[model samples]
Target chain A: MHNKTVAELSKGLAAGSFSSVELTQHFLTRIAQQDPALNSFITVCNDEALADAKAADAKIASGSASPWTGIPFAHKDIFCTQGVKTSCGSKMLDNFIPPYDSTVTRNFKQQGAVCLGKTNMDEFAMGSSNESSYYGRVVNPWGENLVPGGSSGGSAAAVAARLTPAATATDTGGSIRQPAALCGVTGLKPTYGRVSRYGMIAFASSLDQGGPIARTAEDAAMMLNVMASYDDKDSTCIERDVPDYTSTLNNSIEGLNIGLPKEFFSDHLNANMQQQVENAVKELEKLGANIKEITLPHTELSVPAYYVIAPAECSANLSRFDGVRYGHRCADPKDLEDLYCRSRTEGFGDEVKRRIMVGAYALSAGYYDAYYRKAQQVRRLIKNDFTAAFNDVDLIVGPTSPTPAFGFNSKGDDPVKMYLEDIFTISTNLAGLPGMSIPGGMIDNLPVGLQLIGNYFDEARLLNVSHQFQQATDWHTKTPKGFE
Target chain B: MSIKREDAENIARLAKLQISDEQLEKITGDLSNILSLVDQLKAANTQDIEPMAHPMDAVQRLRPDHITETDNREAFQKIAPATEEGLYLVPKVIE
Candidate 1:
């Protein structure tokens, strides 16, 4: 199972070549030694992981096993695990252990996959950079001075640095893809409602969806197989059947029509990013794929509409954490107002509170129709633009982010500058389509990512294309200079 | 449309956040920049546009309103600041 994909690992486990405890121990050693400087993990459940691994071994011995049995994976901290600390990267939840497992976590555990630990994230999934975590900023495992893109930085960094085979991550806006791009890993955000969010901490709920991150698309496909399910617990969960994602890996991309949106190549895009993505497309062309320029005219308006809509939803969702129920509370309060003011002020980071205020203002009594309603209308137009593009192309390709990973203090003192990093990624969420980021090319040695977007419920096709690319190039297999 | 300091603070209060006097000034400037960008969305003609909240207009696939979910109120409430008689406790405002 050492050099094998998750499919191979599962086959070997079923065939009794390697026990679950042995597999879990190898990863634990790597994480213990490597995660200290990377700060990828906030909590490593060493004892619990071993116990789960032993149980998985027993299940396999009793002839009760599945493809996910004995697979070791880490979960993002935002998902609540029963009896495990579920801090969504805030001091408010730093000590808060949950009594219930999130639907995603429970699904993996039911399949007998051992949870290694909770990975770090941007506080409440609000930051474009990993620096917003309450624990401390996570550094890109590629370079010491570079920042790992966020708010799923921990999951990306852990996978890229070989601390874990794969990890579970959520995207609201570009939390999953941006970090996956910056840290040089593979991540997919399934179509909205494709995964259950029952135990996930609320963050821009309308845009949030969870998927997998790993070194290669094949590993991601296997994890996606287990992660996707129709859950009755989450009202938004899709009723569609989950497909065998790995079944399509051998499908050829010959004559596959790929759309390159003109708006993605606007002057606002950094020249270097555009060049690297072009190179990646050229490589795909060599593999028999046909690339075509398509128009997604409403792309430019996505950022503005997203900022307004996302924050507006955030304001309503975050109202639950009033310090009276289940989060941090002020030391002393003379009234309920004082209690709320002090608790929220002390509880949230700058960016989260900034969004809450923006959301509240947009949704306020007078501005609701003007700002919030208008934003929703534009969101529909954005989704329509994508629908129009799919009529001509099987997948849409572009730079996952505008540029490569930035320095530790890059984009500092300017929030808008940081928000632009998610420009290309946000529209996919707006359109409610599946999106994946694959290791594309390098800019000044830091990895850049190429994004592939599929029509709704087209995750299997997206995975097939990414797997073909990984098989052709050694980019996904190459680790950073120092990390290895 | 640069935001005024008073307007910024007013919004802050409405949002229930405490911004210090000095923080209000910086926040005012920041809000101005963001709003200037956000204002661009209003230029599009969307009179006939329908507001979309989801991909489909189908009825929500809700679980039967039965007690499929248990209230581990005692377990969950262990993390709350105050709980009494199975209800979350808070300051009384209508004394």
Candidate 2:
């Protein structure tokens, strides 16, 4: 169960190799025994998962099963799951049970997929490393002393450890791709609004998008099929057609034009990372891709622009978490102001509060033009660079993150250094293009990820290209020593 | 663009989040680090460029205000720390 892909598991279930109940039970026992050390799961949905697994078994028995009918997966704790604890790694929402389910989770449930549990994340999806989570940091399964890239660290770690076949993840400024890069798993951030963000807790509205984390490109593609849909409930969801992602897994990439952004290979990138990404590019070239050099002139401005836009939006979206409505409230406050203050002071962590302050200042009356508005304008130019580049090329390639997984306390007490980790990934989010991270060769035994960015709604091509690369390399299949 | 303790407190007050002096000191340091990056964006040239709010041109599609959901309020509130008279209990206001 641990090493099998979603396609293999689904085939086994349909062919009477084993029932969904057995698979679910196997994963549950493994999670119960192993998750304590990794701290990957914040809440395990045992009862709900078992019930769904039994239903999936019935579907297989009746010859009416979906492709992923019995496969078990987990979600980042940020998604609102009905009757399940959906704490977004916050002390405030520690006991908050949402009345409704997030569109992503609901879609999974509708597919008869078994739920494993809720994985941990940085508090309110705020940090680059997972340390800001109130539930505690998620350690890398490969090396417990190293950090699992976050705020989607738990999802990445869970998939890397083979605790689940795949996990649902959200990326705002590299949350999904960065962690997957560090963990050596395949993760994708579909075009913004490709997957509805209806009941998913807001981080930064414009930048927040959901996608998948799995062991291989094929598994990610299958999960993408289940997750991609237009939900009227999500006001921002695009009303467009979703392609059959799995069908394109074997699509030929004979003439695919792959662009290498020259700015990404500069001296600032670590020597080891440059080597790994360059080697991965060579492999793609061997697969018959038409490789060429391209320049994104606005690459250097992404970090600064993102800090302004994301925090400003975060400041606004997070305002709803006042003590009055839902989540945490302080005890015995004298007035409204006191209640709001005490609740927030108690609720948010160090990283969340830092963003709120920065966001509030940027969105404030006097500073709005200098910070927020200017960032938005530059953001447009950044997107334009990609738009123009795509007209000349089919896809772009870069290092997913600047470096591999660093030590647990590597960037200690320095927020700016941590922010630089997403430099390659933030621009894709800014441009609203589909992006994926395929496992490149390791750097000093730590996994590195090669990033692929495609034209808008071209997730099928991105998956096809990644699938071809995975077929040629064993990096995606190489699991950590102890976990296997 | 460096944030000070007073600046953090003022922003906290504006955002309606309460904070203590000790918390303000640490938040000031962290915000200063973040804002230094924001300061770079503020320096960029955007004299006549229009700000892009969203990447898509699709208008917001709202679900009908009708209840397409279950009446799970009772089940939802079951986990709340305090409740009274079929509503969530919170710190009282208005003398």
The best candidate by DockQ is 1
- Residue-level lDDT of model 1, residues A202-270, one tens digit each, is 888889998999888999998898889888877888899999999999899999999999998888778
- Chain A alone, TM-score per model: 0.97, 0.99
Off by over 4 Å in 1: A1-4, B92-94
Candidate 2 docking: what grade?
A: medium
lDDT of 1: 0.88
| Docking quality (DockQ) for each candidate | 0.71, 0.62
Candidate 2, which segments miss by more than 4 Å at Cα?
Answer: B62-83, B86-92
Give per-residue lDDT, candidate 1, residue A319.
83
lDDT of 2 by residue, A1-484 (tens): 7899998998899889999999999999999988999999999989989999999999888988889898999999999998888999999798688878999998998888999999999999988779999999999988989889999999999999989999999999999999999899999999998999988999999989999999999999999999999988778888899988999889889988999999889865989899899999999999999999999988889999999888889989988887765788888887777887888889888778778878899999888888888898999989989988998899999999888888886897878889998999999998888899989899778899999999999999989999999999999998987889
User: Which candidate leads in lDDT?
Assistant: 2
- The local lDDT score (0 to 100) that residue A261 gets in candidate 1 is 94
Candidate 2, A319: how far from true, in Å? 1.2
**Candidate 2 DockQ, CA atoms:** 0.62
